[model samples]
Target chain A: MEEIKEQTGHMPRIGEPAPAFEAVTTHGTLKLEDFKGSWLILFSHPADFTPVCTTEFIAFTEIHPKLQKRGVELLGLSVDSVSSHIAWVRNVEEKMGVKIPFPIIADLNKEVSLAYGMIHPGQSKTETVRCVFIIDPNQKIRTILYYPLTTGRNMDEILRIIDALQTTDKHGVATPANWRPGDEVVVPPPNTQEMAEERLKQGYKCVDWYLCKKKL
Target chain B: MACISPDGKPTESGTKMLRALQAGLKSPEEIAKETGLPLFRVRSGLRELTQAGLADQKEDKYKLSEKGTKLIK
Candidate 1:
């Protein structure tokens, strides 16, 4: 355990493999490797029954089907017990009329939170700040988002980023600022002069030598 | 269909715009401001949302159709 702490003290970086873990959640026991073939959105909330977290939970539930259609899975975590998680899920369903379909980790020991670097001491010593890690099918961390305790997360942005990442991976291209699906994508800038010249006449909308956009 | 685009695919901006509309953001500019999406993307997303029958535009503002409200509920 000491060795694990030392290794995971630093936050995981994008493009690095997500740290593996096994934990008991509201659904059942799950391992990080269990989601190997699907993209995963591992998010952490400060606590259950909180107003901001509850709203975020509803938003996540609303968008869960869309995420599943794109081969993505959602997992939630907080430094709470399994009983607390179960009760909160029940309460959310009863009051909000939306079922939280994903498993939420009961990180009572803070093991998984530590592994994912979810807890920031400066933010709050007892609870975790809002943290989101977008892991691809290969278990590589693609994007990270952090929100303060007072704010709620934007589920649309989360879904949008998943689309952007998948689009980039599938097309070998980058997306411009605020890019959406069915929109023109950015072509990788050429490294050499010859490549730059060749790119201009490739039937793309080229604004300059290095910048180009083409319909996917 | 609430979040999916008319082309039969899911789009991030489309979802953002839909959520913004559900939150009472009426115009493309307001949607863009609320969601922090680019103006051009917001316009395209609005177009896609309209084509998908989830939203309707008045003189200059947009509102969720009954189908869209049902989807959110």
Candidate 2:
């Protein structure tokens, strides 16, 4: 595992600049900088023509417009050739009749996948594990989620995270468990004692100064 | 039809941006301020709106194209 880690370089953490790359995508050759001004969800599947990945693609497509309305773009990746990616996307569209409206990276060389630490040696040396990287508009890695090979991802959870991250950035607050849009958001705790005393009188739904929820 | 039936309609943000452009908001900052949207969102929306041929950009400013003007109620 350490050897694989050394080979893949360090796995990117939250708050790091996304590792840069230029690679062949279904849309065309694309670079990481191409998506700089937009919020991006760069995800990696194990392979193309797989059942779980297919369902995920359809689900992702289902949310594409919703994400677009919120200023987000989707990019998929795998250690497959451009032809394979193209064929599979077309097959899904023809067979399942679901249009995949995003560019997918064909990482046949695995340079992009390894750089993003998408490949898990323990899971499968040849394939990337299910991984999701939610990058902000500033190109900062905001959130990362990894699912096992067998399990598919939830579209609702994906949308929820984007909402949570965007809300936190816009309103300077954190989300509580199972947060949805229009729900009360948790306010940041006051640092100074003076502010803490004033926090109670501020009319938030407060159990204590450290724990307060407010409507945005 | 698919689950998402996008019948060539502009999204809410896209519509707000088109409306902003029609109201003579030129720069992304101005549009963002007018529509109460995030500056980044305004910038991104301008790119998409331009790509969709509903808006045009000259220098740093944007204006609604004829197609965009037709969509505004």
Candidate 3:
């Protein structure tokens, strides 16, 4: 069972512009302007050097090539020291053979965590829960995902969602459950009788008037 | 594939980069070019940095998210 608590501080939502920030990273000082015209996948974990977070970070990097091809960026966050990020990156690369390709925010002070609503005091003190934000090139908060401390997020699902979002925006269609690229898409429901009549005759994989699937 | 901190924001280590951010440094394109990684990757990285109680982004850029220069230690 999950315990819910009152939200605090600049909570993000789908379709909302994401809160902005400037932070030091392994590479250098990073600003939001850097991401203009690109998609971003921002995520947070409780801490560095932990077993679960370590595995997830490695997995995210594993799909870096694929994500990049899609024009998406990946960043990780936790209230750990830069030293911890370095050690964890080394451990993941050395033992697992996958290098962490992105910077991990050393939010040692928790200011950034609170701003993004990543810190859930009800869940735990002195750490953040698993929170993921899918931001678009416009800096809009396109999607949000929160996971419990016990669960590790699925990278495949994430990439799938990105594919779905980009596809929908590009093609003017929606995604159905378990949707994948090259699969059929769902046509938005027609609001008028005229569209319904034309919908059936249109060249789409229409299971019915309101539902259709198409290749991405 | 080591990214080699493409932006040259001057982080001695990943953690130190974050610390310097907490203190302040906000440039996105520099981060991308310096990292040799994708621009989106840098944006996502900055977001994560802020969400984890460490950094912040503003006016389309990011700086150390810590509320102030006040280090707990």
Candidate 4:
């Protein structure tokens, strides 16, 4: 397919290195390495001055503090020029009563969008669709989220997911359904018969012998 | 335990959503038609995907989250 042909480069994958980027941001020229030693949430919107994008941008800006406390940095991108990003950021601050302290890439060339697979043909040809990538401090891709044009994302869910991912990575466990920070985690099923027998003796909450539960 | 298909497809509802997504039915109506799931189920299933941040909802369409995209691929 022509679409497939257009995406020939080796795209970034979870557990793989996130492609490095150096571009002019709202403040000045910035590089991906500048965010070293912290988690990065790289997301994209279609364009500026749009209603839906504005609401999402405002929400992300508001949640930046919470994201920062957990060692996450926020970077937003769109196919808009530097001037456009500045204007929109100013407007968002003035009209929405929030400041976007993060660097928004002025990706007019569509380089970052393409590398991140943010552009989808069905969504819009010229503008990037909603895409969110959670890149870890080691520069490995941790998680990715793609959204349609109509619905808005829940910021709390994003926060919770990062919390879950951080905890899962730390403890080698899986968070259960409706998992919140400080809640019990779902223990991984014992992989062997011997281990299964010993696991039940631990007195973890279990729906069955192999299904153990413990708080994170 | 739900087993993945020999062809690497996910379990029943997972496979249904995958098939629908591949067919470009990221909307409720399209998913129902392709998977024979009720509209409510399709919506709720998609909601589950979104709630866990596995799906992104924007404007009026649905698409797999970047993480969901990788999982399906």
Candidate 5:
């Protein structure tokens, strides 16, 4: 585990500030700071015009409105040119009738891909594997998900992350396993012995002092 | 073939460009200037509108298609 950790140490970890980058996208010249005020999902696929990526793009489009409602913006990246991205998006709209509303970065130079560690040498030397970076409004990397080139990502889990993050931030509570909105939340454990003893008498449902559950 | 999907809705930029076309704005630059959208946005919106069969490009100018006209009406 230590060897694996050392090998992947260059990749940004959760709670770290996301690496800043600026590049031309289908929307325009956009920078990481451009999305600083809103939650951003910065994801990368292997390449354009591929099968799994196509389905993923369509799925992302279907969830774009939901993400926007939660104040999250989506940005995609690949080591393809802007023209290729445009053609591929247009092709998707034309062929599949699904419009991609978000901008995709044309990281032809692979600068942004390299910075985000999207390129897995074991996966492919030239193309980026599927990687998703969930960044918070404060420009912090909140979560990172990596999928192999053959697999697509789960849209529900992506939305759930945003919901979980927002709910926890607002209520100062942690989510339990498989916790969806409205499910009971895990309460922060008490530090003092008196508080621990009193925790049981409090209104929360406690499996133990350290494992109390509450609804916010 | 229908340009937009059955469940498709017009995006904000798409609507603005459609309104600009309705107002006789032709070129993308003219549409951008009229709509107060960025040039890049206008370009992309035009592409989407054209693909969605909401706008027609003639020479360097764009005008609303019949479907787009009905939409605005």
Candidate 6:
């Protein structure tokens, strides 16, 4: 485990500021600060023109508008060149009938990839594994998800997590497992006995003192 | 058969216009009337289709290119 940890490098922690960098992408130069005041979905795929990555790109394309409606911007990354990125994007549009409307970073130097701990040498020394970083508007890392190369990601789950995170950020509450939009949210428990007693009469559905759920 | 735009994704109106063109609507007015879309929208959709190499215009008449025909299929 320690060896694996050393190989993976430093993993960014939740609530800590996300590692920042400027990179050359298919859409030209982009800086982390450019995404200030908007939620950013910074993700890494293994490579371009690969089967799994292509499918994931199409899925991401399908959800682009939905993410935009929620004020989320997606930025893809791979250890590929800008020319390769453009050709792959064009090929995807021509063959799959889906436009990848997001910018894909060309991290040939592995600078940005290393900063985000995306290049797990144990997985593959030359390629990045599937990794996702959900950064909030305040630039804090809110969530992280890692997937093996064989398994494709669930776009709906990503969206659900974003909704859950945003809800918790806005309302000071938590969500149960498999929580979807419009569901009742869980409120944090009261700190004192008097507050616990007050919480019971606060019109929430209190299953117990520490477990209270309410519609927001 | 690529649908090209700034995003390279076809818009609803663009798809409608392409369908109307494939169905033998020759002019923008004909496409607009057939699809119940505005003339301006039809014109822009035609422009997008043409720019995407899916359609061709000849003497103010619109026809689907081989690529456009394959796309509708």
Instruction: Kindly list the per-residue Cα lDDT of model 4 for residues B1-73, writing each as its tens digit.
Output: 1113335445577557755675442666677678875343455456556655556776656777777677877
Candidate 6, residues B1-73: lDDT per residue as tens digits? 1224457656566777788888663987788789876343456467668878889999888999898898878
Which has the greatest TM-score?
A: 2
Interface RMSD of each: 15.7, 9.7, 5.5, 20.5, 9.4, 13.3
Better of 2 and 3 by DockQ: 3
RMSD of model 6 against the true structure: 11.4
- Give per-residue lDDT, candidate 4, residue A146: 85
CA shift of A38, model 6, Å? 0.5
* lDDT by residue (tens digit), candidate 5, A89-196: 999999999999888999998888878888887888788899999999899999999999999999999999999999989999999889999899999899999999
Worst 10 residues of 2 chain A by lDDT: A1-10
Q: How high is the TM-score of chain A in each model?
A: 0.95, 0.97, 0.90, 0.94, 0.95, 0.95
Winning model by DockQ: 3
In the range A163-198, model 2's lDDT, one tens digit per residue, is: 999999998999999999999999999999999999
Classified by CAPRI criteria, candidate 1 counts as incorrect
Candidate 5 C-alpha lDDT tens digits along B1-73 = 1123336657566777788898774987788679876454566567667777888989878999998999878
The native-contact fractions of the candidates, in order shown, are: 0.00, 0.00, 0.24, 0.00, 0.05, 0.00
Cα lDDT of model 6 by residue, A163-193, tens digit: 9998998899999888998999999989999
**lDDT (Cα, tens digit) per residue for candidate 4, span A103-165:** 788898887888888888776778887888998888889998889877777899899989999
Name the candidate, 1 or 5, with the larger TM-score value. 5
lDDT of 6 at A115: 82
Model 5 chain A lDDT-worst window of ten: A1-10
- Candidate 2's TM-score reads 0.75
- In candidate 3, what are the lDDT values of residues A1-216, reduced to their tens digit? 233333334566788788787665554556656667889888999887788998898789888889989989887888888777888889878888888888777777776777788987777777889999998989988889999898999999999999999998898989898978888788888999899889888887787887766665
State which candidate, 2 or 4, has the greater TM-score: 2
